[model samples]
Target chain A: MASTDINSTVETVFRIEQARLIAGLTRMLRDVGLAEELAQDALVTALSEWPASGVPDNPGAWLLAVAKRRAIDRLRRAKMQERKHAEIGRDLDEDRGDDVERRDAALDDDIGDDLLNLIFIACHPVLSPEARAALTLRLIAGLTISEIARAFLSTEPTIAQRITRAKKVLQESGVAYEAPRGEARVLRLASVLEVIYLIFNEGYAATAGDDLVRADLCGEARRLGRILIGVAPDEPEAFGLLALMEIQASRLKARVGADGEAIPLPEQNRAQWDRLLIRRGLEALARAEALGGADGAYALQAAIAACHAHTGRAEDTDWAHIARLYDRLGQIVPSPVIELNRAVAHSMAFGPEAGLALLAPLETEATLRGYLPLYAAKGDFLFRAGRYAEARAAFDKAAGLSRNTAERNFLLKRAAACGPARPVMR
Target chain B: MRVMVMVKATKDSEQGVMPSTELLEAMGKYNEELVKAGIMLSGDGLKPSSQGKRIAFDGPKRSVIDGPFAETRELVAGYWIWEVRDMAEAVEWAKRCPNPMPGPSELEIRPFYEMADFGEAATPEIAERFDRLREDAKKR
Candidate 1:
């Protein structure tokens, strides 16, 4: 590749690798800020050098090796300081090479509490869940503010401000860099898990863009979950959250077609489902269950996923069990979205009337006013019940409200299936 | 008395790889040194860009995207919250540290805004609610 190509490649890869690099650098520099600076220096080196050197086989490791050297240089300079002159002069008298060797040794310590702590720090309670999510996505996930904004059908400036303000608040509040433990950790873990899930959900059901899902987002969330498992192994909710993500992510491959069209859950091919993720999700679920996640929101969501995972086809789904789980989830974390999901399950468990009845109350909810899924789910129930005119109107409204191209297409198709619109009811 | 060190991440540091064992120890020692020196109030590193995401809001609508971002110069990789007497002390400590990056790195030190700085502009309700806001975050 030409130097230009090499530079571009380095930049692209850097986004993917930034978190790992910062994690590594923070250990050597002992300053989160310093570690980030060192990591940037590594990028600058690559930008200047890689054009001619070509990308290294292990580009990340190469950058890390380069960053650690810079840390050593600082140590040497500090050793020569006036305050350290007496001790440093004596130490320098022994061997200057020893200093280099020691610095090298210090740069490579590997038990990784720093990276784990970094997660908690990024997901700190000082910011809103959205703010924390944005910051984590920007700082830890290496996502651009615009890309994050696009994922949620949101605007770039708002996301950018959220991230900037979140950092400012964290700075102002004197939040610690280490992970919280004991009772405090419960709060921290919930935020962390929510951030991860939010990231995954965006990928799994992208709010905007042409595609229905962003596989990269799903993959990244799973990666974070696995890391969280290592960090907070005993936290059942952590495991539950991971399990939920893993199981849900397993369907990504089958959720769309070769043509990039949306494939509803009932229509998805189980054969395309990732068995590995299923296994992992089940394992994580087992851990959550063992740790007593019976009442946890994530665990309940995981249980709901399990219901889907256990069945071979959509027809085989245990809707009654899913309805119960949704009910439980709603009780713990009451939200319009949870209710919407439960209504779907109720429709599946009983019949269209049951689902429509469940959804009837949500019509008055202000928050669900612009929510497309509500109309789509209600439309599905109405369609099944041979209420074509009403279903057609719902689907049309869903098509109008949805931002996802694939989802919009699906809703439009459903509307078309419902036949001609003739003074349809709202 | 408190200052924050903002470290910018370049597109290069985010690789899906672990640092060598030696590097990890070196980092721990460096943190230990900072702690021993009393310059570090607290510090920690972040995960690679691949591990995070961003959420952009355009009014009530939200958008998200995966990371390992493109811009290196403007990106914030991590931060250190330090307790120091003043900017001079913060700079002095920053200068004493090893170079942050493998090639070369820069550290940007910024002071935290004091509550008093807000003066009468910030309502008491806003100030009191700040803590409550944080606690609310914990619940979500």
Candidate 2:
């Protein structure tokens, strides 16, 4: 291989190894920020040495060994500084030596646990959601500051500062560097799942961006979800979350029109849906169900998506089954969003009157007052019921509330289609 | 984006020879790593070309061709569709793959063309036309 190929190869290997290196180091040093720095130090060492020496047989192990040595050197220097300042006893040195040896012995073991602990720490509820996302991408995904910034559409320095502050908060709060147990484990796992889902949604549906979907964030979140499943294989909810993401990601292509407009599920070209992802998702959903997660929020949602996946033509969708699933889901999660979806499903399965009846209570809901989808759903039901004027008004309301250019255009078009031969009032 | 990584067929693969147990084990482990990393969407190995058939298309005519095909190097023994951040990431993962054959082999990585790649040409009308064509083809 040429010198440049070797250089690129070294960097690629480092990218693959960095997460494991940092996870193991954090377990040893008990400091995520310091572990990251030492990992970088090891990368630097490899860049200088590996090009000429050629890559090692086990590059990850090589990098870990180098980082461990640097960590020990740093610890020894810090202890020496403390000794010089306070004239500490020799027994302190002996205790430190034993501690180092013990940590070293435990380093190679429980690496999977170490990785899971690192993920839990990164997604700890104490940190702000943005900070948690930035930190997770940085520490767990081995993404650079610029990559994180590009992914989130933020500036490099802002992301760097966010990561820095998150690390400081983690250190000051003194979160344990180990996975929780029993009930605490369940709670912590929820937070981790929430962060991953949030990342996925941020990519799946950009809340505030010119781009409709940022596939990179979705890919990162899916990768993290898979890692979580690997480490916590017994957690049914983890499998559920992975299933949900995979099923949703499968439709990413069909979800948008060629003109960059959002296409409702019924209108999307089903041929574009990725069959492989759908199969993977269904398999994951089965796993979740086998693990007694059938009622889990993500599992239920994945099941609903599967209903659509099973049908080729839109008219062939099992709307009645979907409505039943949504009804069950609403009982478990109890969100207005679920209620709105249930209403739509009911309308499709039964009639527009049924949907309108279900949505009547939501009209008075303060949370749904400004929600664009509620009005859009109302407009569709009203249109189907032949109440053209009311449908037009509802679509107009939805169009007024929408911030996305494509969505607003779609709503405006719907509104125009509602009335007979009248000029649109913009 | 997504890329299809194809393991090119070697003479050994084209001869319908099965992989050794050790090679299969290594490939299985590598696949597990890919899944754990979450890049793999789907993957599978194909039977030898001898068991496959090909269709040839002309301007207005079609002909059927049976394999084993010539040019072993151009044949694909197996393939994986991986969603990656970029081509660089895809290359990194492909480099880590266990060699598919007992002898010299190659892995080719080609990215799928997304709708976005079409720029302004990907209007809804064109897309609908293509969809209609596909539906008609499926019916046939």
Candidate 3:
């Protein structure tokens, strides 16, 4: 690589591995903010040294090594006498300037498994869902505040403040920098799973912007799920989450056209399905089931994914089973979204009226008041039932609520199909 | 052990928005449960930050600063002091407290010190006496 190319590549690698580096540093420093600052200091050292030293074989290890050395120097500078009591790990007997090798080894080994623990700590429910999601993307995914802000259609300062408050909340709660066990584990685990799911959904269906898929988000979310799988192999919900993501992600290649337009699932080319990912997803589902079927929310969702994976054609799907699974899911966790989904399955299984009956009750719900999918689903059922006027109104409402160019276009097309709501400025 | 359950305050809570009238009745019942179980020592709400002051001392100088501190994040609007056997028991009580900030709030359970906390040979610098003095003065 050319010199400048190599320099930029170093920057990119550091950014990619930023979370692992911070996780390592946070363990050593015990302060998330300070750990990040120290990690940045290491990045600064790299920008100045890599060109001169020609980039180390393992750049991540090199950054970790540099940060560790800096940490010891920092501790010494902060008043050695105070840290002396805490320095049972340190050979304070040796000259303070000497024994750099000892400090590096001590610092490096203690933080090897810390990154995953940091993810759990960051995702603790002590913070709001927004805060937990933002913090996870920052600490585990290694995303910049601006990068995160851009992904969510939010301002940079707002994202920054959200992250700041999240860290502060965890600290004030004394939530600890370690993973929980027993019932406490279950409480915090739900929040952690939700954050990862949100990250994946953002990738699977970009909330805003012209593009139908933001593949970068998919890669980040997948990486996070993979990490969770490794960290909590026996936790069935974790496996279920990873499995669901894998199966869903398996369809990504065919979800968009060459022109970057959205491709509805039925119309997409199945030949483009990633067989390897599908296999992995199937295996994860098996693992989740093997672990047990009274599975947590994520595992139940995985079972739903498996039904889709096993089908050869969209029309051949066992909608009856899907409806049953949705019913089971509703009983397990009552949510308006789940009810909406169950209604769709009911339509597919029985008839449009079956679905409409389920959906009509949700029409007056405060939670579903502004949700686009509620209108979209209602419109679909009405159109299939041959109520063109009702379908047109529902579709128009969906189109108004939706901001995604592709989604809005799709809904408008459905509205136009009812014949008479010819395309206008709306 | 006397565990002090610190209910982190919010702007709405401090405005005498004492839960809803319905929630107040639910809370009265919950407090009854606490009393029946013999855990509730004391519990009540505080006035808004508009009626509060933050005092800072540097050497002999004292700056008494005055509240709706509008700093929603820092306000500790109310608390319930409970004498619990251990941390686990304290958590159980906190779980039962009527959701203090139905809109946006949290309850923090912290352990309080007893008189025997300052036993023989305790260093003056790190003494419980100084800590107790700071705690008493702050509440005043």
lDDT of each: 0.72, 0.85, 0.73
Instruction: Compute the TM-score of each model's chain A versus the native chain A and list the values.
Output: 0.73, 0.89, 0.81
CAPRI accuracy category, model 3: incorrect
Reference interface contacts recovered per candidate: 0.00, 0.56, 0.00
lDDT of 1 by residue, B75-106 (tens): 66668877554475566556545555554566
A1-426 in candidate 1: lDDT tens per residue?
666656667776565457777865654443555666678888898888888777676676788777777766766776655655554334323422454664464345412354566777778887888887877777676767777787666789999888778767876787765546657867877888889988887777652234322535776677677667765567799889888987987886566554456666766666667676688788889999999876898889998998888887577788999999999999999999999999999999999999999999999999999888999998999999999999999999989998767778878999999989898665
Q: Candidate 2: where is the Cα deviation over 4 Å?
A: A1-6, A80-112, A207-213, A420-426, B121-125, B128-140
TM-score of 3: 0.63
Error of 3 at A329 (Å): 1.1
Q: Relative to the unseen true structure, what is the C-alpha lDDT of residue A51 in candidate 1, on a scale of 0 to 100?
A: 81
What TM-score should be assigned to candidate 2? 0.88
lDDT of each residue in A1-426, candidate 3, tens digit only: 578866675666676557778876775556777678788899999988888887676677889878777777777677656655365225322332434664474355322246666877778877887888788888876778887887776789999999988877776777677546668777776778888888888777663232322445665676677677665566788778878887888887566553346666655555557665677678878898898844567777877877877776676779999899899999999999999999999999999999999998998999989999999999999999998888998999999998777789989999999989643332
List each candidate's DockQ score: 0.01, 0.42, 0.01
**Model 2 residue A291 distance off true place after TM-score fit, in angstroms:** 1.7
Q: For model 2, how does the per-residue alpha-carbon lDDT over B42-83 read when each residue is reduced to its tens digit? A: 889999899999999998899999999999999999999988
Tell me, by DockQ, which candidate is best: 2
Q: Which candidate is the best by lDDT?
A: 2
Reference contacts reproduced by model 3: 0.00
The first chain of model 2 has a TM-score of 0.89
Better of 1 and 3 by DockQ: 1
